[model samples]
Target: MSLEIAISIVMTLVIAATPILLAGLGELVAEKSGVLNLGVEGMMLVGAVAGFITASLTGFTPAGYAVAALAGLCASLLFGVLALTIGANQVATGLALTIFGTGLSSLAGAGFVGTTITRLPALFPQGLAGHPIFRIVFGYDVIVYLSVALTLAAAWFLNHTRPGLILRCVGESDASAHAIGYPVTVIRYLAVAFGGALAGLAGAYYSLAVTPMWADRITAGRGWIALALVVFSSWRPWRLLLGAYIFGAVMTLELYSKAAGFALLPPEMLAMLPYLATVVALAVIAMRPSRGRLDAPRCLGKTFRAGA
Candidate 1:
């Protein structure tokens, strides 16, 4: 590819990766804090719908994102309550949360079908006026910049902050944290809520800056991929960022390859790139027989009773 083509490809990857990066980062925080939130996909759906509806009504993209994030936070908070406070099964509650989110989204967005909104504008000014490299690196709507910032912030917070230390403590051993007066349940609750907000923001980015339209299955399976990426990244924020972009590049290349007359690969294979990458990564991780065991929280998915 020529320099211009290369720049274009990189730009496409950056655009494609923005949403996944957001979701993956959120999942990273949730998991690192010692909670297995299986409802990320559901949270994304709720965000998409909530953002779409609010944006359509208010004609303001920021307001849409705000409501969407709140909606996602509320949805994920419910799941945290079930899995942490009530001591429900994490897997079951997560599955139920997905179902509930899907149904609620459908009901909420039924009237907004076939609608479209003028998405939020790109943030880069003269920097991207005609500079291909600069545009590729800095050009994009507000969501993309925010997502990237969040990634850096998350990485820094997780690796170098007191709250992050407490979070990691809760994830590694809630009992230990509680004994040290860490308020394990509260920490987990907030972590899950933050995760939800990010997930929602990711979904809103899709609706407001990507598709900019309301539709069912809008999120497709991006949520699952984000979940997979968290595991593939070993719950590291920066690794999660890298993995998400790779997945995003694969997704974009799949489409471009098919459209660009590259008949070298099967159409089906291209279509399966996202899910296939997840499986391949998981397999690679699984094959490392000598790899150290994961340091999952002692009571990560278990309910925390106050005095039980």
Candidate 2:
């Protein structure tokens, strides 16, 4: 491949990875605070529809993104209430939220099935972005850059800040955190809300930035992929970024194979490549002797009661 082709492939990889990176980072924060939200896919779907609808009506992309985040937050908050406050089973609650999000997004997006919107505005000037060398770095929309920034920020916050330390404490030992005067429940709620918002924004990026159109199930299991990325990264923000790109590269290969009509593989096998890679990667990690149980948050998927 020529330099331009290589750059184009890299750029496409970045775009493909952005949503997963964003969602995985958000989920990392929530998991660090001891919450396992399986409804990220649901939140993303709602965000996709909400963002698409708002953008279509208002003719403003940012407004659609804001509304999408809000929609996701709302869906996640419901999970927080049941799992955090009511002390419901976290896994079941997350599954139910996903189901609800699927139905609700489909219903809301029905009118938008055939609709398309203008792409979100880019941050850099077209002249600069179009330059061959410059385009490699500057051609992407703002969300792509924002996803990288968020990953770095999450790594910093988790490792350097006092609040980050406290959040980790809550995840490590909620009872101990409570004994030390930190409000475990409150921290978890906030973390979950942040995760939901990110998931929503990821969804919005699909309709508003990637495809610039509305469709049912637009995310197409990316939310689940995001969840897998969290595990694949061992819950580290930087690792999550790496894992997202790796997965994205596989997805990009699938796209290229289909578009080029590569006869070496059947269409069905090409479609399964990304998912197959995910399973293989996870299995490899699981097989590592160094990957102990302690790698994950101690309280992950466990609901905490304030008084208990």
Candidate 3:
């Protein structure tokens, strides 16, 4: 690729990865709290639909994002109630939530599939827009800023703050947390909801800024890929950023290649590149032995109760 092409690719990657990073990091936080929310894909779909509809009508991408996040938070509440409070099977609830989100999104956004959104206001000054380093890294939408800030905050929360320590305690051993008078179920519930909001925001980014339109499966199982990224990152926030950006770059490259006239592969193959890479990467990681899990919370995916 030429310098300009390479730079353009990098820019697309950052934009594409913004949502995944946000969603995955949020999930990292939720799972670290011992709640396995498999409904990220569902939450994202709903967010996409919700964000698209809101922005199309209001012409305010920010407001659309807020609505999307709210929708995601509300959708996640069901998962929280089932998995955390009622102690339902986490995997099953996640799948159900996915179905629920998909159905709801399709129904709600039936009228928005081919729509378009205006470009978001640039973050940096016009002079910075063409700057090599500044434009690619710092010049992003407000939500992009939120994603980075949240990742750092999550890192600090898990390592430095008292609440962070306590949240970790709940994730590591809910019974232990309860023994120390922490509201185990309540904490997990809140974590799940926060996670949902983040995922929603990610989805909204897709509708309002990235793809800027409504399309069924626009997320294309990005939720599952993000889930794998969490595992790929071994639960670390910074690694989540790395994994997300890399994945996003790969995804954008596939599209760019097809658009640039590569005849070697089928157009469908190009579209499949990102997901195929995610699967292969995860499989390789699964086969590894010494990558030692550094950021994994102690009791991720286990159901906890007040008296159990």
Candidate 4:
């Protein structure tokens, strides 16, 4: 490929990876605190629609993102109440949250179908952001950079901070954490809310930056891909960034192949590439030795009861 083509491809890859990276980071934090939320897909959809609607009406992308994060936060809190407070099965509650988010987003967005909005602008000045060579490094919007920063922050917080150690303790042994006077349920609620907010912002990236338009399920299952990415990364933030980019490359294949007029595979099959990668990655992880899977938090998906 020509240098320009390579640059274009790399730029596309970054855009494709940003949402997954953001959502994966959020999920990683939650899992570190011992909560397993499977409704990431739903949260993304809700955020996408909410962001699109807000931006469409107000002509401001930032407001849209803020609203999207709040929407996701609300959805997650519902899950926390059911799973943590009411003692519902975590897996079941997560699934229900996904279903509810899907329906809620679709219903709320019904009137906004086919709408268009201004794409988010790049963060740097046009001279830098639009330059042929420099654009490679400076052309992206704030969220792309924010995703990387969040990765570094997450890694540091998990390994270097006192609260981080406490969170890990809760994940490994919530009963022990509770016995030590930690508020297990409260910590998890905050983690879940954080996850939901990021998931929402990731969804907004789809509507505001990737496509600049609204449609049903605009995220196209990227949320599930992000969930799988968390596992594929062994719950490590740095690995999650790497995994998101790898998946991004897989997803970018569909667009590049279509543009390059490669007809060896049908368009339908091309579209399946990312999801196929997700399944394959998950299978590979599952087949690893039991010890390899021990990187996951010990109390993952377990409901914590204070007195039990």
Best by lDDT: 4
lDDT of candidate 1 over 1-308, digit per residue (tens): 57787677877888778888898888788887778888888898899999999999999889999999999999998998788888898889988988888888888889988989987766867657357667776667788888878989988898899888888988887777888888988888898999899888888877777888888878888888888888777777777788888987887776666677776568787767767776777777667789645434455566666666
TM-score, per-candidate, Cα-based: 0.93, 0.94, 0.89, 0.93
Ranking by TM-score: 2, 4, 1, 3
Model 2: weakest 10-residue lDDT segment is 256-265
Ten residues in sequence with the least summed lDDT for candidate 3 = 287-296
Cα lDDT tens digits, model 4, 161-215, are 9999999899999999999999999999999999999999999999899998888
TM-score of 1: 0.93
Q: Output the better candidate (2/3) by lDDT.
A: 2
Q: How many residue pairs clash in model 3?
A: 0
Residue by residue across 1-308, what tens digits does model 2's lDDT show?
Answer: 56877788888988899998998899999999999999999999999899999999999988999999999999999999999999999999998998999999999999988988888766799997788878888988888889999999989999999999999999989999999899899999999999999999999999898998988899988898898888878888988899999988877866665676665567787666656766776787778898745377899998787778
Estimate, for each residue in 1-308, the C-alpha lDDT of model 3 and write its tens digit: 77778888888888888888988987988998988899999999998899889889998777899999999999999898888778889999999999999999989988887889885777777778767766876567678778888999899888899998888899988888899899888788788888999999888888788878898878878888788788777778988888888888777777788778875567777666656765676677666787544445778778776776
CA-RMSD of model 3? 2.7
Off by over 4 Å in 4: 261-292
Position 188, candidate 3: lDDT: 82
Query: What's every prediction's RMSD, in angstroms?
Result: 2.0, 1.8, 2.7, 2.0
